[model samples]
Structures are given as C-alpha cells and as structure tokens.
Target chain A: MNQIDIGKWSQRDLNMLRTSSDTREIDLLTTSVRDLNATLQAFGSNTRSDEASFRVLTPNGAHAIAVGIDAPLNVEIAGHVGYYCGGMNKCASIIIDGNAGQGVGENMMSGVIHVKGDASQCAGATAHGGLLLIEGNASARCGISMKGIDIVVKGGIGHLSGFMGQTGRLVAFGDAGEALGDSIYEARIYVRGKVESLGADCIEKELRDEHRAELFALLKQADEAHKADVSEFRRYGSARKLYNFHIDNAGAY
Target chain B: MCGIAGLFIKRTRLQPRLGELLASMTSTLCSRGPDSAGFALYTAGEPGRAKLTLTSVEERADFEALGEMLSRAVSAPVSVVGRYTHAVVTVPADLVNLCRNWLLENAQDVRILSEGGHLEIYKEVGYPDDIARSFGIASLGGTHGIAHTRMATESAVTATGAHPFSTGPDQCLVHNGSLSNHASVRRELGRDGIVPQTENDTEVAAGYLTRELKRGRSLGEALKSSVEDLDGFFTFVVGTKNGFGVLRDPIACKPAVMAETDDYVAFASEYRSLTPLPGIKSAKLFEPKPATPYFWEH
Candidate 1:
C-alpha cells in the first residue's frame, strides 16, 4: 500500500509542496486503482495553492478512475475509461484523451471534465455543478436528470438528452437526437443543428440576448467559443404542462 | 446485468487467434456477470461435414459409447470428442437432420447445444474464466465468435439457461438484457413450429431469428424486425454462417460498445472487454445507436 500520510506533513511543509509545480505520472498497468485513488484522495484532503498535475496512463476502460476528488488538481488520462470517470469531482480539471464510458461526470459538484473523444450514455447524469465538455458525440441521456451542471458537446447527442432535467444548460453544436428534453424542468437546451423531436412538455423557446450571453459564456468556459456561432443556436425548455396531474393528461402519465 | 463480447476477424491471418482474443475479451466481463458463461465459435470445417455440440448432466451415462451408437445409426464414420460434460459430434452434412432425429428419439438425456457446419457452442454454470479454461477456448481457432456471461435475471442459474443460444444452422444469438414479452413470443413461435428448449427469454429470441431466417429473411432483416416485435431493454449480438449483426432496442438502456479496425470488428457490453484485443488502442470505438441494426459479412 503506497499510502501517503497527510497527517504527518506539517502545514509549512504542505505549503512548500503546494507551491511547487510537480507533475506525477501514475501508470494503471503497474499501479492498482486502489493505490492511485488513495494517493489522489490524500491530495484532495490537503489544500494546495498551485495546481498539481497527474498523468494517468493506460486507463483501458477501467471504472471509477479519478473519482471523488475534493481539491484543485489537473488529471490527464491517456486512454479510455469505464463507468463514472471523474464522478463527484470538485475543484479539479480532468481531461480524458480518449473516449469515456457511461456517466463521465455523474453527480459532479464543481470542476471541469473534458472528454476528447465520444462518451457513452448518461455523460453528466444528475450532476449538480460542473462544466462537462465533450469534443465528440455523446450517446443517449447526455444530461439526464441534471440539476445544475452545464454540458457542452461539440458533436451530436443521442435521444432523450436532458430528460427530466431540473436545472442546467445543455449545449450541442451538432444535431440532437429524438425526444430532446423530454419532460424537462427549468433547464435550458441549445442546439445548433436539427432536433429530431421534442419530448413531452418540452418545446422550443425564444433565444433572447440574455440566453445568447449565457451560451457565449458556457462556450467560452468550455473553450469552444470560436467553433460555434451564438446566432445559429436554438433554445428548448419545459412547457410546464405535466407539472401537475390532470384527467386530460392521464395518458401521458 | 450481463456481459456480451463478439469478434469478427476480417483478415484471414487473424482467424487463428479468434478464440484467444475472445477469451481475453470475455474474461474482463467477469465482474458484470459471475453466475454462468458461454461462447459460440465459428471455425473452419471440412466440406460435406457438420458438427453438433451436445451436453449432458451425467456425461458417463450419455456420452460413453455415443460415437459407436451414432456411427451405427448414421451408417457413417462418426467422431465424438468429449470435453467435461460436453461432446462435439461430427457427421456427414447430408445426415444432420437424420442424426438430430435419431438423437431426439434415442438420446433423451442429451441436450444439443448447437448444430451447424462451422459453429460450435459451449456453455456451463461457472465463471467466464473458468469456463474458458475448462473448454480450452484460448487454444481453439475460428473466424469469428461471440461469448456471454450471465447474471440470471429471468431464469434459473443452470447451464441450459446460459447464452449463445443456437437455433439455426451456423447461427447463434447472445443477449444482455431481459425480454418482457418472451412468453407471448414463445407462443407465437410455437405456432410456427419453432419451439425454444428452455424458459429463457434469450433462447426465445434465438428461436425467433431462426424462424425469420427459415422464411428466407436475411440476418439484417431478422434483427431489424426483432427491434419491433420484441419488447424490453436488449442489446443483441447475433452471428450467422458468414455474418455478424448487432441490434439494440428503442429505449436501449443496456450498454453496448463496438470497435472496428482493419483486422477485425468487435462488440461488447462495455469497452473494457475490447481493450485486450490487438490494435485496440487505435481501433475506432463507438456505442451502437438505439433501434439500429449493424451488420458485417465476410
């Protein structure tokens, strides 16, 4: 067990280590996930003024890589990851150089997760706060049940994206698949390409100047502002029809 | 939840490593399903010859002297190779139906796992790694293969309930999700003279595909129709004599990832299953879309 004893390090020593720009490389082929996560968790418990960069190699679709971090850190994973990569992340910037499996940033509290390749279903499902950027396509339920997260996809999104979204912003530069924003709440959706269909209680809304500003900010935060034009995007949100039960809408229920 | 792994070798040079690659692929999914595992391999066979994979609970009572009895009944040179509780029997292609009928009448205790020219199916109630090792799967050679690890969602944890259910000659199907309308579909197929051997829903799906192919529908057509007729969350990987097909339901909650390279095409319930394949680092990976059928033929 290559465990780090954070308790033994004095505050002065921790401050000195935090000020130094140290880059650590952890190879998944040689190190077990338990050790890697323990080391990262140790860093999470210790506050640092400078960003510590950790490069993880050969993830090979392993689940729960770099999850539950609570401090500022920069993680670069060189290969594909399985379920829940960077899940519950906070104050960290995690970049996946390859594709990611289901729920890439699920339930993340705050931070940024950038997936260079495609992502599987439920990319940012139920996330509360985070900026999830997918450079490639995202499969079904890209932001399903999202609360406060902001997701930006450079490519297309599959069906049922933002389904039952409570509060969030989902932006896609490419086409949106079937049933976009089905039964959505206060969440806002922006699509530059074709929307195959809208789901129950989800309808297109006016993209006012305020929305344009918000979209611009999100795009800039995702480092994709230059790739898309704000004028080309359209917005969708809840119609609030299914918010209450009624006899006329019993079939939908 | 269950796990499914499939490999189709496009390059002939890579055929010899099919079983080896598939073994490594399926082994990674042991955690997803730990109850039972099975695989169907499409190997090269001699012309005018067919093979049947048979299994019995009591191997000594059912498999011993089976070759001599089958040889006398078929009036041909029959070879039976027994491995653990399963046996592979080879006979003349023209005598396949006769052999099947003879076994049905005489060998009541033996169960047929597969019957085809090039396909051989093996399954048992155990871990995927144990099943693969016991069958010596890594040493076998084939052009394509599909494997499954079962968690026994809708059926008992018996060897017969395992996946890679074969219903047609040189055809097999593996499923990762449970089917809701299997009972009704079973009744419908029964009316067409296609009966499933077990109460397993996946076997019924395999029976449905067999019926469609018997009606002259292509593999792609059969899979496309399954999307409409079958009700439930499912991701199916089916293989024929020279083709491989994949299909997911409309509300595809089940996981399915696919990878393709210049050498081979692979499918799995998760990308982790494919990471062990050669050149997987550079393979084109993507999730199969919902309600869509993707097919490849050699």
Candidate 2:
C-alpha cells in the first residue's frame, strides 16, 4: 500500500521499514544492507528479490536483508547477501544473482530458494519446504532438520550442517561440513562434492542413476557455472542406524 | 482452519500442560489453517464417544435442531460434545451405531469429521491457539490422538474442511494429498448410500473407508483397498480406538514418517512435527516405503 524509496530516503528512515512486498517492481540500485532490508520489507508475498529472469547488476556495499517473507517472493540479489537473507519464506522463489550469506533461506517452506553466491555458515539450518540452490560455496549446518525441502549447494558447506533433519533432501555442490546428518531422521542428503569429513552417522553411498538424473535436472535448471558435468560429486547418507534411537549413538552432538 | 493436536498419555500421568504441547504444534501451523480450532480427550470407561468436526452449519440454531433430529433418526442421544465452529458430537456407546446412521444421513449437510473413543476435532479459518482455547482440546487426556495442518489448496478453507475426519465408528483420518479421482469416487460411493460432506477428496476417502469398516472389514483391508482403488498422490495417518495407522496412495507423493519405541510412537507428514511428541529424543524414526500401509496395533 506504500512505496518508500530507499535511494532517496535518509539512512535513518531505512531501518523503520523492516519487510516489504510493495514497489518491488521498481529497480533502485544500491548495495547498502539498510536499503536492501527496506527492499525486503517493501516486497511482500507476490514479487521476488531477483526472480527467475536473470540480469547482471552488482549492488556494492550490502550486508544483509535477513528475515524475508513467507510467500511466493523471488529475488536475485546481485553479488552476495551477508547473512540470514531470504529467511522464513512460504511460497517465494529467490535466486541470488551472486553468492549468499550464512544461514540462507532459513525456516522457509514451499518455494524455491537459490544462491548463485557462495553461502556462509549453517546454510538452510531449519527450513521446511522449497528448493535451495547454492551455486558457489555454502557454510556448515546446511539442511539441518530440513522438512520436505531440497538444498543443492554447488560448492562446499561448513561443519555440522544437517545435524538433525526430519524429511527432505540436501544436495551439496562440492564438499560438506563435518558431522553432517548427525542424528538425522528421515531426511536425505546428496552431494556432488568431495567428502572432507563425514558427520556422526553420515557415510558416502553410491550415486545411483536416479540420483544422477536428479542432479542433472537441478543443474540444468539452476544457473550455476558447472551445470553441465556432475559426475565428479559423490553421494552421502545415513547408515540407517539413526532412523531409530540408539544408546550407542547417544551423542547427537 | 486452525491447528489440532492430541496425545494419549500412556506410560504415566500426562504432563500438567500436555495441552500446551498440542497447542504449540497447532499454533505453529496456524499459517496453514487460520479459522477455528477444537480438541477432545477421553479417559478409560468414560463411556463417552467423540464426534470429530465435519462442517460449519449456516445457522447454529439450525445445526442444533439437526442434531436433535439426528439423535431421533438414528435412535441415539446426541449432544454438542465439543463446541467449535464445526460439529463434534458425543454419544453413548449404545448409541454410536445410531449416531453413525445419523451422520450418514446428515452427511449432505455436515460431515462426521471424526468420531471415536479417544479424540474429537473440528477447525477452520484460524490458528490452533484460538481453537485450543475455545474448544479446550488441550485438556483432553487420552491414550492417542491425531491433528491436521491444512493449506487448503484442494479443499475450501471452511469448518467442513477441518481435519481428523471420520471413516468409521471410532475411526478418524488426517490426510495431506490430492485425490485425482474425487469426482468419480464420489459418484461411485454415492450409489452405495454414502454422502460426503465436502468436495474435498479427503472427505470422500473418509466416507468410503467408513463404509468399508462398518461393513465388518478390518482397517488394514480397507486401507489396502485404497492403494489402487484410491487414485492420485497422497499420504494419510488414521487413528482409531485400537491403534495408529498410516497409508499412502499407490505412490507416496506426500511425505510421511513414523517413529516408534518401547515407550511411545509418533508420525507426521514431516519429521519436525514429531519433535513435540513425548519421549521424542529417545524415539526411532523410519519412513514408510511408497504405497505401503503401516499399522501399530495397541
């Protein structure tokens, strides 16, 4: 119902607008996190940050637009987001024009969240539904307790990603964090990257033909530089012991 | 509409704020259904039957009048067992058969959402917290219960659309899936004197399953009948007087998980939902194979 332009507004005025879905149609290029936060607040459920249609725009000097909406909003944040960007979405579709921050797309359900940017730590720590795409790098705790969501980080993730997942899929582009899928329950993790270290109960498994096909489909759709070849990556999953509670695997840490 | 959560406190006395846990699950899922909420809990030898929610009457007085008529029509004594936006009736065990008959006849106007021994429900157009406060579902202390979190993509977000719908006496079902053959199935079931309360395929499945179970078929057989007979991608969890049950269409398009241990058991469309159940950290969780029906008999 309102349009508060960040480009013209003073810095003090920017913080007042916490979230958005208005006038997201107008492209005001600035890289300040305060302005971008205003942009996140202005754009509500119907629009996107930088949705499906791609364009090259580098907004310099931005930190974060954390706590995005819970609707079908999309975004292509040029360059990278600092931290916790695109968090808590419902039916939005966002693709980072560049790399992303740590904990990207946290607690999102029912949308497609992509990060062409290298993600920081704990990417997708506790998401519900939707597909998360990380093109370059991803930090630790990716897809932890991820319920019905799928994450494909093209690069590598930090330690302790996916510590306690319920139901969903986590696909890594390169390598994964340590203690991945520890105490996991019902969620599936697929990685095309190397296994620097396995989580508590995580183990490398065969990348079946079905997995190859799925990776191919995602790569073809996601705008990553390595869209063509996914043969180098391997798959990791639970040993099925974590499916049930065990005294031997007592330490979920 | 709103959220619903039921837990049967078996091993020991229920937590003092057991209702709070259910309220949390329902309220957390408030975005799914934001209209109304209700809950019921029955203890041993209460001799009280629960009427799960089915529909929102155009007029409350008219719905009450219908309740009276249904009691006489089915030769049972019916009462507004649980008050909410929808219908939740409680009858004596002797009158359950008559109540079922009444529910069948009145299915056109209302749905017998869920009627059983342990739990009762009806919800719409709100979050779970509002419903729990109004219906006092948080207070029900039973051995087990089932709740619904709805998005209403396929079904209208109405009281009739509230979940834990009835399929048979002492049987209520919660589902998360789309039924492609809803119209055809409705037509087929209509020929057999079963009237569904809504256009939602979930209610139709409930009606069909109710008919099958009342006709002396076991729940497993009735559920197995659904694999091929029920079309489309779906996964459902049905709760009855005897135990907990899980079912899916020929393909398990919807997500579901079951966790069991010597002390307790839990299942949800997503694994995170199970976190609130008692003894969760100590539980063992497993996913059901596609189209396979899993049952935990008490």
Q: Quote model 2's TM-score.
A: 0.51
Per-prediction fnat: 0.76, 0.00
Cα lDDT tens digits, model 2, A94-129, are 656655545677887656666755565567778866
For residue B248, what is the lDDT in candidate 1?
95
Give one digit per residue, the lDDT tens place, for model 1 in B1-298: 8999999999999999999999999999999899999989998888999999998755554564887898898899888877767888999999999999998888887889999999999999999999999998898899899999999989899998999899989999999999999999999999999999998999999999999999999888899999889999899999999999999999888999999999999999889899889999889888888899999999
What lDDT tens digits, residue by residue, belong to model 1 across residues A32-150? 88788878877754666365779999899999999998877778899899999999987677889999999999999777788999999999999987678899999999999998888
Stretches off by above 4 angstroms in model 2 are A1-253, B1-12, B15-19, B35-56, B61-82, B86-92, B96-112, B116-119, B214-217, B249-251
Q: Pick the candidate with the highest DockQ.
A: 1
Candidate 1 — which residues are off by over 4 angstroms?
A1-20, A44-46, A49-51, B61-64
RMSD (CA, Å), candidate 2 to true, equals 15.8
What TM-score would every model get versus the actual structure?
0.95, 0.51
